[model samples]
Target: MIPSAFDYAAPATVAEALSVLADAGDDVKLLAGGQSLIPVMKLRLADPAMVVDLGRIGELSGVRDDGDALLIGAMTTHHQIATDPLIAEHVPLLAKAAATVADPQVRHRGTFGGALVHADPAGDMPAPVLAADAAFILAGPEGERRVAAADFFQGYFTTAVDDGEILTHIRVPKYTGWGAHYEKFTRVAQQWSIVAVAVMVRVEGGTIAEARIGLTNMASTPLRATAVEQALVGAALTREAIASASAHAAEGTDPASDLNGDAAYRRHLAEVLTKRAVIAAAGL
Candidate 1:
C-alpha cells in the first residue's frame, strides 16, 4: 500500500522546516531519514497531510564534540553514528547499539533522532540514550527547550515533543573511562530485541562505583533498572552480585505479551540479558 496523497517540501534550513511544521500544525509530519515514518505511511498507519522533509536541512546533520558532551544533530544517520570516531570515543555503547539496528540499508537511512522520536520500545537506541542520560534540544515557534531523555519518551510511539516542535539535536554526555556494553537478545541477526540491556559502569579499584542499567522493550518506555543499580552499588564485581541485581530486571517493568514473547518470557530474558550486560560492562 502507498501513502495517502500529501504535499511534500524539503526545507533547506531548520528554520524553514519549523516554519512548515508550524504552519501545517498537526496535519504535518517532519521527515528525517524517513526509514521509520515512510514505512508507517506506506501502511496507512500515518497519513499526514504534509511532509516537511528535513533531509536538506544542513544544520540538523552532524556530529560534534562540545566540551563535556557530544552534540549530535537530529538528522544524523545511524550509519554515521555507528562509524563516527567522536561517538565511538565518547559513547561506544551507542555506537554498538547503532550497529545492531536492523541492517546496513536501514542503518544508512535511519536517523538517530528519528528512531528516538519515533519512540519504538523495541528500538535499540532508546535504552542506551536513557542509560547515558542524554538530553534533547527541541526547536519550535516559541524558540527552544531542553528535555532529558528520561522525560523525552512518554510511551510507546509517544514523546514529549509538542505539536509543531522539531527535535533539533541530542546532547550525549561524554563517557570517558566508562566501561559500557549493549547486550541485545534477538531471534535473528537484525531483528528487534526480544529483550535488550544497556549497561554503563564506572569501576573504581575493582569495585562497582557507579552503574546504570537500562532495559529495552521491558515497558511502555525504555526504563532504567533502578533496582539493579541499587543492588550493584559498592558491591564486589562477582557473578552472585550481578545475578542478584539482574534478577530484578523485571521487578517494576510492565512488558507486553506479543508475538515476540510472553510477559513471563520477557521477564526471564530481561534477567538473563541484564546479567550478561552487567558482566560485560564490569569486565568480569
Candidate 2:
C-alpha cells in the first residue's frame, strides 16, 4: 500500500513549516519522527494533500533549561528523552515511559510531541506526560499558544493542535528526586499496552508526601488517576496504603471494549497495575 501522491516540504524552521502548512490549506499533515503518520499514510488511512516535514528544523530537537521547568523540543526522539541527563534528573517519569515505547528502532524514531499529538490511548507517553502535568506548545501562523496536558488530549487520536498548527515543544516542570515507574502489560514486549500505569511518588521520612498517577488504555484518552493520587498523598509508604489507593484507579474511567480485552477486564488491570506501579515508584 502506497500513500497517495502528495506535495512535500521539508522545512528548516518552525516558521517555514507553519507557512507550508498554512499555504497548503487544511489538507496538510506535519511529519515529525514519521513513526505514526508514515504507517497510516501507507495504509491510506490519512491521505493528506501535502506533508510538511519538521525534521529539518534544528531548533526543534533538543532540551533547554527554563528556570522551574524544561523545554523539550517537539522533534526530540523517544530515545533521546529516555537517555537525556536533564530528563532523567528532572523528569524521570517521562524517561521511564519513553523507554517502554515499542523497541529500539521505534524509540530511536518516535518523537515525543508526535506521540502526544497522535494521542493514542494505548500509547505509553501520554499517560506519563499527563501525570507529570506537562504543557504543550503549539506554533501556528498566528503565533504560539500553550496548552496543558489535561486539555491537550481531547480524545482518542485527537488533540488541541488545530489545523495549520505544529506542536513546537513540551514544557515539563521539574519533579526532581521523585521516584518514578511505568508498569505496562502486553501480550509481548513492543506491543501497544493492554493496560498500563505510570506513577511518581515523593516520599518524605517514609510518608508519601505527594503522588501523581496516570492510566493508559483505560479510556478514550490517557487519564489521570486523580482519585488514587489524592488517596496516596500523606499516606504511609506501605503496601496496604498503595493497595487501597489502587482500588480507585478505575473509579472514573470509561474504557472501550476491543480485541485485546473487554472494558471490565481493562478496569481490573488498571487497579492491579496501579498498585504495582505505585509500589515500584515508592521503592517499597
lDDT of each: 0.91, 0.93
- TM-score (all chains, Cα) for each model: 0.97, 0.98
lDDT tens readout by residue for model 2, 8-118: 999888888877777898888988889999999999999999988888999999998999999999999999999999999999999999999999999999899899999
In candidate 1, what residue range of length 10 has the lowest lDDT sum? Answer: 17-26
Q: Which candidate is the best by lDDT?
A: 2
Give the lDDT of residue 228 in candidate 1.
91
lDDT of 1 by residue, 5-47 (tens): 9999998987888888777867888888898899999999999
Worst 10 residues of 2 by lDDT: 13-22
Clashes within 3 Å, all models in order? 0, 0
Error of 2 at 74 (Å): 0.5
